[model samples]
Target: MKTLILTTAALALSAGAALAESHAQTVRLGTEGAYPPYNFLNDAGEVDGFEREVGDELCARAELTCEWVTNDWDSIIPNLVSGNYDTILAGMSITDERDEVIDFTQNYYPPAASAYAAPSEDVDLTGGVVSAQATTIQAGHVADSGAALLEFATPDEAVAAVRNGEADAIFADKDFLVPIVEASGGELVFVGDDVPLGGGLGVGLRESDGALRDTLDAAIQSMKDDGSLNELIVKWFGEDAQTFE
Candidate 1:
């Protein structure tokens, strides 16, 4: 009887462990509320954008609930490292500099960085001038080229600066800038061909959370396969702006 009781207790413990391992809950996602059409707070202060939509779909597909926390762009990665959030749904490009600190899931969206100028400005495209935010990869591309570089704390500010003639051009990821341009009426125009910025936005996970990353990656892959990603892109970016590969 003692042996049988001990065996039963061991089985119960094993079952409990299995259940714990299978039902991880409540993934906390982080985003910068400043970047629109990706992840930003709407007028109602609720998160609404492409990334938020995709993140919600992913969470549902993965059978997990998520709570989004807003953090500054510069602090998002650091906060993730410190356990302030589990993943970043912000439209963060996967760059080597960032890769050195955190792990990213497979790219979910491709982005082209392009420079824009006010419609009235005669930007010399023949000169191949590129304006980019100083801290971004786009800036690095033109850092040594002596191109007209205009930097700003946020993409919105950069767009505004261009509209106000503070700068002749503004460079940014295509996905983030397209909507802003449309909303600005005839204030801006693309100055050059869109440049392929390597690395698409992906969910950021801690190095220790490989399992969670794998789960989210699978869900994202499924979304891509079923045309859900394209649908979301079109919904946010308009019919002609949809681009997926």
Candidate 2:
């Protein structure tokens, strides 16, 4: 979905050990409170979405006290490395570039495709301007798609860029774009074929937090084994959403 930078490699290593030792305390869960159906701010201003539900359940299964902390998508990874939070459960896709900076639990959400949304199907996807949230795989894809890439700080802004004619189309997760397109009442429509990206969405952790990563991975595996994880995916993403076998 999105990418981020990291620092404090030396500190990240030690932080994991300390976090592992202090597992009984509240394990801070980091998330970008912007993406919907993944992680977003609820009406009460609390983190709420598919990831939140899955994260809460994982914490319960792991017997860990966890709390959600919101952060900007661009800084989510750097903050984790700097110990701002212990884990990132914000629908971050697992990619090779990201793995070099941080650790990820086995995917809680399966890989999904990215798609384009435009005011019309005639928008030139290959030769015209495209909008995407900065630091996201979508933006990266846009940069390489022979289209002019317009980067925005947030997904909403990126979509706005398209609606306001600042760009020809917006590229993002199909899951994220579905409701927006449907709610647009014909103002927006899906354009082009869906582009599959990344391994899947997993819990991101500091590179040093191997123990915490392993623990979370175990919890995720348990959910998958018993089918509760599939239930949660279906509950949040609808009947057509992907589920574990």
Candidate 3:
């Protein structure tokens, strides 16, 4: 989960309910292309992953023509307010702090725990330096904890900080970290306890787009009702991942 505080002007734009909607029938979905399983660039250099599939399905159900757009994680919300996109389908958790800047559809993915990964089991989580993507809940948690927080621009960079010994461990979404730890082939291992955070991952939109939010929320609920959303969650995050059901 990630969040960036928007400027006062950006908040003003997001709060303006009467702003002219310029996209017509096409809704542009924004995502961070580096977060695997959630969203990432495929071999074809197109946005592809769990969120992509879900987003496409939602758009189809909502009868909205949609396009995918990628942006850096740190600037995602700001860009959304700036009209770079109409919706944010990134792995964004629903939190009060974020609600002040953007509206969210009901979560498609259930609340998942955050975990720590390290090269060894003995790393001291309470006092050691832990790496996390800047502006993420994990980073906020680490900064608040007794551990020294090391911030990076991306998840890969955070993991690299641990691997290269710049940090003692990397803390991130448990769902996002699991595949990386598994593929690390024992080079990296889960450590410490899991920390549950946020309400779950949902589609983020501007307050001015309440109509669009309702449309997407209904689509997401339809998927949940038919169990297709659960199927997608398992498809990308494995059987252990949380589901709406």
Better of 2 and 3 by lDDT: 2
Q: Which whole-number lDDT from 0 to 100 does residue 233 have in model 1?
A: 83
Alpha carbon lDDT at 232, candidate 2: 92
Tell me how far the alpha carbon of residue 44 in candidate 3 is from the true structure, in angstroms, after superposition.
0.5
Write one digit per residue (lDDT tens) for candidate 3, span 209-240: 88678677767766776689999998998887
- Give the poorly placed runs of model 1, Cα more than 4 Å off: 1-25, 119-121, 124-134, 242-245
| Least accurate 10 contiguous residues by lDDT in model 3 | 1-10
lDDT of 2 by residue, 1-245 (tens): 11111223223434444555675578999999999989999899999999999999877666677899999998889999999989998879999999999999889889999999999999999999999999888899999999999999899999999899999999999999999999999999999899999999999998876778767776777677668999998999999998877
Q: Which residue pairs collide in model 3, if any? A: none
Instruction: In model 2, state the lDDT of residue 82.
Output: 97
Report the number of the highest-lDDT candidate.
2
Clashing pairs in 1: none
Evaluate all candidate structures by whole-model CA lDDT and list the values in order. Answer: 0.72, 0.87, 0.86
Better of 1 and 3 by lDDT: 3
Model 2's alpha-carbon lDDT is 0.87
Candidate 3 C-alpha RMSD relative to the actual structure: 7.8
How far out, in Å, is residue 77 in model 3? 0.6
TM-score attained by model 2: 0.91
Backbone atom clashes (below 3 Å) for every candidate = 0, 0, 0
Candidate no. 3 TM-score? 0.90
